[model samples]
Target: MNQRAMIAATALTVMSMGLLAVPAAAQEKEKCFGISKAGQNDCASAFGTHSCAGQSKVDMDKTEWKYVAKGTCKDMKGLSADEAKKMKM
Candidate 1:
């Protein structure tokens, strides 16, 4: 292949690979409440204890969240995303 043709082909291949990799990497995670260990949360608390991740002073606080795979949180030992959203906290 010519230089320009080879470059274009390589670019196209890389782009296609990246596109194919996205969904597999996405894997559908959802925020599960009251499941995060101390300092291991995914984001801020719903109860206003902290403003960001990694600030939880206690494990399974019911106000903190951690990302769990979707459809699996309900089966887990903690609150599901929907339940967490409905919570007053």
Candidate 2:
């Protein structure tokens, strides 16, 4: 009985320590925008600086990049290229 209790206590302690690590791991992923200089130029051209400003940019492929629009863009939800251009960035 004592051996079983000790084993359970040890498992609980290990699980608690792992739980404390979750927040730190989540914070590391908070930065959503990270793009190379070339990728930056491409996005700026494709979306235009006014529309793409403050949006998350990422290079999904070596030669291809994307700007992830948030906030106002999210309101529009799904917009075509022309519709997106008309939106306030």
Candidate whose TM-score is highest: 1
Count of residue pairs whose backbone atoms collide, per candidate: 0, 0
Candidate 1 C-alpha lDDT tens digits along 1-89: 89999999999999999999999688998788888889999898886768998999998878888888787776767786567767764
- How far residue 72's Cα lies from its native spot in candidate 1, in Å, is 1.1
Give the alpha carbon lDDT tens digit for every residue of 1-89 in model 2: 69999999999999999999987665421111223233352343334443443332443222222343333323323333454445435
In model 1, the Cα lDDT at residue 8 comes to: 98
Clashes of 1: 0
Task: List where candidate 1 sits over 4 angstroms from the true fold.
Answer: 1-24, 85-89
Native-referenced Cα lDDT, model 1: 0.84
| Model 1: pairs clashing at backbone N, Cα or C within 3 Å | none
Maximum-lDDT candidate: 1
Worst 10 residues of 1 by lDDT: 80-89
lDDT of model 2 at residue 10? 96
